[model samples]
Target chain A: MTAMNPKLIALDWGTSSLRGFLMGANGAVLEQRGSPHGITALPEPGTAGFEAAFEALCGEWLDRWPALPVVAGGMVGSSQGWREAPYVRSPADVSRLAAEAMEVPTRRGLSILIAPGVLSHPSGGAPDVMRGEEIQIAGALRLHPQLAERGHFLMPGTHSKWVDVRDGRITGFETYMTGELFAVLCRHSLLGRLMPAEAAAPEVAEAAFTRGVEAARHSRPGDLAHQIFAARTLGLTGEMPAAALRDFLSGLLIGQEVLSALGHSAQADTPLALIGEEGLCRRYAGVLQRFGAVPALQLGNTAPAGLFHFAIAAGRVAAAGEPAR
Target chain B: MTAMNPKLIALDWGTSSLRGFLMGANGAVLEQRGSPHGITALPEPGTAGFEAAFEALCGEWLDRWPALPVVAGGMVGSSQGWREAPYVRSPADVSRLAAEAMEVPTRRGLSILIAPGVLSHPSGGAPDVMRGEEIQIAGALRLHPQLAERGHFLMPGTHSKWVDVRDGRITGFETYMTGELFAVLCRHSLLGRLMPAEAAAPEVAEAAFTRGVEAARHSRPGDLAHQIFAARTLGLTGEMPAAALRDFLSGLLIGQEVLSALGHSAQADTPLALIGEEGLCRRYAGVLQRFGAVPALQLGNTAPAGLFHFAIAAGRVAAAGEPAR
Candidate 1:
């Protein structure tokens, strides 16, 4: 049998979704695949279930490149996931994250390095933690080296994160349940019943979203709980169209998030880095700009690049690497 | 059959539950019945479905008291309910709510007066409205006439309301989705997964709840979305026990609501009137007191009494009427 060569396989395994990327040494994607079989989808906890799911997703690539190293992150490292990778407390850097990576044995004798999440504890308060986001943070730092000096990074998603980075390390962070709360309100609450069943067009939503952001900006920060009810009353009075209620809600929530994040720090005048999907990042950028903060947008997939960066940092991949093309 | 006589049938038909009261002329409850067949549970909308659910729950009582007028409130008066009773704009008094009541025809040739909800619009912001709570406010006014001069009333429920009363009229009000948000978070979000399935004991929960209130009091208002994530991280770090998460969440939400309410009004030092069920009102009072606001607690059922007050104000029953026992 001929010896096969590949640079690396990167995986982002969250609670309900998984994405796998096969990449070249130059950080170019060779192939990409995804599945709903995330860490939560495993039939059971432990190595067997993790191995089965991983094999189903990337076994063919492993068969081809028998010695290729695999890098993974996200909920797959939590206590509930395949193996518990203890969180490295912030202020954490790429080196600290790499040092805390846990190794798991695969049936096919392949190397799997799982990156650890970072936890932050404020003075005299409960702690906050993030897993896969740490990887994305690393990737963002690599792409925009200038961001390493000092900046706030906003990652929008379910449990959106606002991270404080100083000198290339995550000094501290906080999580906002903005996305998750939006989903719940839309699907399970009375406010959702008033919205149109289908989402409004992007342009229509963007306008309503702008109105929501403006409203949030003008209102007192504590009034968020009160302001949210406007989503219902506006529809009731025909002031806001029914189709636009969803976007308006999205804006209200995201606006509150931005306001809250700003309230915690005095960096509103400085440029804030946005790390996430293009659509969400664009929306967040719009809100931040409206709220008097300069927003610097970063688009594209960061998890795979982040995993690759982690692998290099951990010395699993050689510093000077080449594609096998 | 002889024309039967009673004071009035007071009904609280909300979105998800119904309560019917057979009362004496002096506002004494002679009989009471309730069911989960709220307006939303009606087999249909318009008159037909509402009649079916109403008859199923209170048909026998109505049959006996053929001449008794029925006063209904809550979502039963909303556009989605049996009939739409237009909202009376604030600053409105009990007389204004009574004047706006809409009468619907019934199979038994009886009059059913549905009281109107109240809507408040701040000069340049979105409007806020509440239905059943309007009746509760009227009842509170009757019980504590002093409140009519000037007072802020806090009604804790799914959509908690902070109402301002001045000079015998409801000047304005704000709605907070605190209770509803708590339910959604505990039942649908990732934070819920960390809480104990069963609720904690009263004493244990009280301590945790107090901690949550203190935490909220010290933190910035807009940080609630961020603060909620503590429920998960605390459990992860074993800083907070799983059984206590539910109460802790309850405290966090209620604390935010109280804080937001206080932020809107200049009457923080004045005692805030609490109108709701005993358990929830007690919790709100505790949080309010902990946050340095004086809480004036009102217990017992307010809906029925409010309905009777509306009936009297609307001249449905004579001012000097007596029960035909």
Candidate 2:
């Protein structure tokens, strides 16, 4: 797809990977690009390498249409990114991204705006931070105005974010490094060594996942590490499927977030909206319900939606927006 | 040391390595040998390559002291060991080793006896198991009868074990897997990626260790995985010593064990005795005290002393037996 007259280039750059969508003024995707390169791959933090990597991946589209404005989010705004865009603490409006936006210096005549992440530090729970999900959540709300009212939002990715919204503003959120930890533990840690040669069926993982979440809710938190060993023992003794161990681990993590969320506020049964990989998000929704949260899984490219919505609200979008590229 | 009168060889093999000590009828150290061969390294589990590896390392001793009576302990009796020496449930006696021993039919004309590890399902705490530490602890008690009474026993190694004793029997114990996890986390996990090029300094590690123990006591136990990020964050922010993260990690593990122990028992002020590397043991004592446990750090070679004492009690040596060769 040619970027001839795309309204905006929305980019989601995180720790280990990057994704971008060329969107029309109406918030419809015209073209998309994704790569393994992420903020973590930069040779030097906050160096030209960041720009070089992005240019290498997205230069073709930009060359086809030189005047397209860009809005980027995720780890691209951290201290190690192109420019440090400080987090806006909740309660935050969708316009916060545009309001607190940091301009990136570019060699090409392209105006690029990097959206800052959001941080929520309530009194009891651990301080949660996000860079990319904020833009998506904002976009999701823009797509469906009804979500502006009270609802729980789950943005699932490497560092899965669960955000709470009320009256068109983000009330607070929590970050669970679920995906990253799963990869690390499953591929690198002792747990990986103990895992069987073959992964179990998804049905097994699903069951284990459910049990794990429930276990996390009832058990003392410190007992989690030991419980992992129990999974292996059960498997070794022919009591549990190995695939379920992976689900159990996932359950433990998500269950922990659910438990922490419960600890933070009294609204445990609030309806939850999820934005993430379909399967993983469904797993999380299932876990949320286990902890008494009503959750709904949503589908869409949230970054572009969020960037476009937030950009328009912040008056960053040009008046002569192109709805058709 | 020559195997002048090697009567039998007592071996304590584990997951990663093997140790065999040759003794005369008096349970005296005739000659000792260790090798890279561990239970994991063996060609197959359950004693297939056990004899060959044993003979390869100390065959000379066996030949010199012809027709020796061999007694082994630890993983040698595990499912992964030479033979599955079934676990002996507590309250177990030393005579159980000689009476219920699993004998390996050897090609070297040596009558090999493998000691059974201990397994206990405490009425209060989660089920626990011991492999080599049971024998070592038994040996330590044989050497120091006073310690057989109510006191604390710390056997620090890969899976560092903290054992509790009351009235001449092991009431309960907890295995921290501290060393094993430390090695895994430092070399394999994402946490290791954040470590400085140099090793953590002793002083810095010591300080972090104390703080970590305190944090473990007061912090939400379920938040440990996230809390680990603090090690890197503290170092990055210059709020904590960079090299001390290792110490902090150690402290956290030990602190967790201490917390678990105190949680399950009514007596928190029972005298503590640590048996491990002098420095590590001392550090453990310090952290234990910081977390409100009265501890005593003992200076000694864990394996030799523990083995010696355990051998005498296991009846490998008669009361009037000759000194170790």
Candidate 3:
């Protein structure tokens, strides 16, 4: 009674949340589910807790297709997750990433392979690393092969990644704590004291954000610490409304990140491929466009695409089959 | 019998703590006292609560010299403080600062003048302001008049100030949130999670700090956010000890601040006058020296000296008297 189409399960398990995607042989998503039981939320560090959470999240799919192989990525493969899938150093590609996947046995007969994160050792700088984003990058290259030829990819989130891809491989990348800094400043710093208690409306946020971007564009790199205080001054001077302070701060941080990335990279004028959630990606895209970098937006989640690519490369899923197009 | 020496009280009343200096007419500290009852801890926002806290901290001195005039600086003059002393726009000197001091009536028939903060509008940049640090700058100038000729003064603290003084007046200044960012990162950010619970010892902190400073000196300004993550990676890689992470972070932030300030100012090669608490000032002096800026350390409390200068300029105290030397 098994379904005619063979399927594979791809899980994007992170520190605080988990997403399970059931995909057909051709990389088409069959069913998807999410849960808060991420690595940090699992009962314990052992196989039992991980299996329990995994089953709870995807037991229905397993019931429909008992032998579906699961490929998980992100924190689920970190030291604290279900199993430690050691990081693969750059320059890395889908093949190396897939080859490095760690296998774990489940109570049921299903096989699970966890994709490894990527690390880069800059010649004279501190090492850079990324976990889930590498999977997304793999998926991005699969979706837009043109990105592999030569392009920068920006995955904006808590720790935004500015990645450089050359000849279908990740050459190097830099991670900016822009998102985290924005959150901390808005929630914990004196600047946060001036923001409205609730979130600002979209239009209000957009306007303030634009102002912040403009400010950063005209400022020197060393002036960030000083520029941040402008949030308070602008509010006090009645030039910027208090409600817009939060978005303004967000815009400033993001704008600074973009400027910093461009200043550090050789691809300032080259178009960037942005892959992430719509809202954040759109925000990044807008800022990029404002700064004169053409940003090609690839919306919707890419973890499934990444996981599916890794699955096929690992020989867990047949590569010859057509996706359910 | 009233004290043989006529005296003035210099109060450094900030948000979290209060310090009162009983100064002789000759600008020598006769007695000093401190209390936890800062502006924030005062019972209420009005004059009554302020008076109560003031009495609790300095009632002894007031009793000794019943008609002594009090010169207060710092947050005590903010809108949330005892009385709003409007900020004097720069390029300001002690004269301009003294002219803008606000007077408030006390229950004991004593006069209180709160010295104004300084505001800087850097032409194309946002306005910058500082409350207590302006007083310190005045004191630094008074202690060593050479500083006024032309010098860069770094007052390192929660909101570190880099001041440009020329010809006995404050021309411009920039504020860096180094200390606050360190606190927030070590207490709230993921970086904090990897640090030891207790503060690092001086020697340990110094070594780690030097390393951080060196790393920062060689890095591009845009790479700071990425470089900060090196704290985590270094810990993971066992290149940096866990106990030293705090100091390393402190070093990295201070180093970045120094670099940024120098980069933004015209005084890169000029010796820096560091005025603040001994420990923080020493830390800054070391970092400054490492970066090839001759750091002249002005130790001990400068608030009293600053307050004395303001008292004389405002005509609350006689101008011809020499400071006790």
> Residue A210 CA error for candidate 1 (Å)?
1.4
* Candidates sorted on TM-score, descending: 3, 1, 2
DockQ-based CAPRI category assigned to the predicted complex of candidate 3: medium
DockQ of each: 0.67, 0.24, 0.56
lDDT of 2 by residue, A150-174 (tens): 7778776555666889898888876
User: Fraction of true contacts reproduced, model 3?
Assistant: 0.41
Which TM-score value belongs to model 3?
A: 0.94
Clashing residue pairs found in predicted model 3: A26-A323
Cα shift from native, residue B317, model 1 (Å): 1.8
Candidate 2 is graded, for docking, as acceptable
Give residue B3's lDDT in candidate 2 (0 to 100): 28
Which runs of model 1 end up more than 4 angstroms from their true locations? Answer: A1-5, A43-46, A201-203, A268-271, A321-325, B1-5, B43-46, B56-65, B269-271, B320-325
TM-score for each candidate, following the candidate numbering: 0.93, 0.83, 0.94
Residue A27 of model 2 has an lDDT of: 77
Off by over 4 Å in 3: A1-4, A43-46, A199-204, A268-271, A321-325, B1-4, B43-46, B198-204, B268-271, B321-325
Best by TM-score: 3
Which DockQ value does candidate 1 get? 0.67
